[model samples]
Target chain A: MSHTTLQKKKLIARVSRLKGQMEAVERALEAERPCGEILQLLASVRGALTGLTGEVLDDHLREHVLNAEDDAARAEAVEEISEVLRTYIR
Target chain B: MSHTTLQKKKLIARVSRLKGQMEAVERALEAERPCGEILQLLASVRGALTGLTGEVLDDHLREHVLNAEDDAARAEAVEEISEVLRTYIR
Candidate 1:
């Protein structure tokens, strides 16, 4: 498969897995699992989310930010990314 | 500043801002903010975290994964990333 196809597959797989993990967390809460285990699961899920985000972002930067044809596109990409950053920082 | 220096600065700034945002979320809980607002904040924070992760991962892929010296290093990099993915999926 092409790199893009491979990337999409990886991303989809990762996200689906994460969704399951998150569902498990919800089930654990409903089942009154130990707070410690729930917290650990939360942390792990966060990490996984981070990892998936990193991979997608990496591809975006490489294919768009770095290789865009003009400065406007680059600036637009940066601004788009900044919007994302702002969301987390608010 | 050199690109590396700029990258480090950006990463630090982004992460520090994220930390502050998280603290705000905690404070909001203590202050008994509406659940809707808290959920909004949580979603925003998740977006920001994704953006930050993307930036760092992009840089890593460009500077390390793509530029690695040999096949072994490349394989190692993939495995390293797989470990991260596993954490999220589990």
Candidate 2:
């Protein structure tokens, strides 16, 4: 039961099945489907929400950044993770 | 450039920087820093990666999933997505 409470119950059962696949992709766009089968169900819900955001960023980089210790707080936590990866690769 | 190309570029850049942070973390450990500092760096890295992942997922959802047309295709897509989510959350 540990392991972060089993990863928060598997991220709340995969976000409740991704909210039932976004309500079945809005009921296949109100039943007027076609566009390549709704873009393959929106690429399988964007690959299942990018695998649930990479499993919560790989469990926050293995339990808070690989078990940090110090050196200016790991260079200020890698410069605040490079400013959040430069604002998410913007 | 095309959106996909731009996304690729951003991903590459972010990954490269993440690599640098990894090296820095290693150095911090080698220097026998403190635990708190190291953890911070790791957290930052995780945040950055998560942001990047979200960006990609959002783009995919917008361009591929949300714009789909058909019914069965959409259903299949959603199912595939569910599978992915299950794997990741597990």
List per-prediction Cα lDDT, in the order shown.
0.54, 0.50
Q: Please give, for residues A1-90, the per-residue lDDT of candidate 1 as tens digits.
A: 222344544544554566566566556545555333444555566777666555545654665577766898777666655555565455
Report how closely model 1 matches the true complex, as a DockQ value: 0.02
For candidate 1, lDDT tens digit of each residue in B7-59? 54454455456555655655554555533343445556577766654454455
Report chain A TM-scores, every model. Answer: 0.80, 0.40
Worst 10 residues of 2 chain B by lDDT: B1-10
Over 4 Å off, model 2: A1-90, B1-6, B68-80, B87-90
DockQ versus reference, model 2? 0.05
* DockQ of every candidate: 0.02, 0.05
Q: Which numbered prediction scores highest in lDDT against the true structure?
A: 1
TM-score of each: 0.47, 0.43
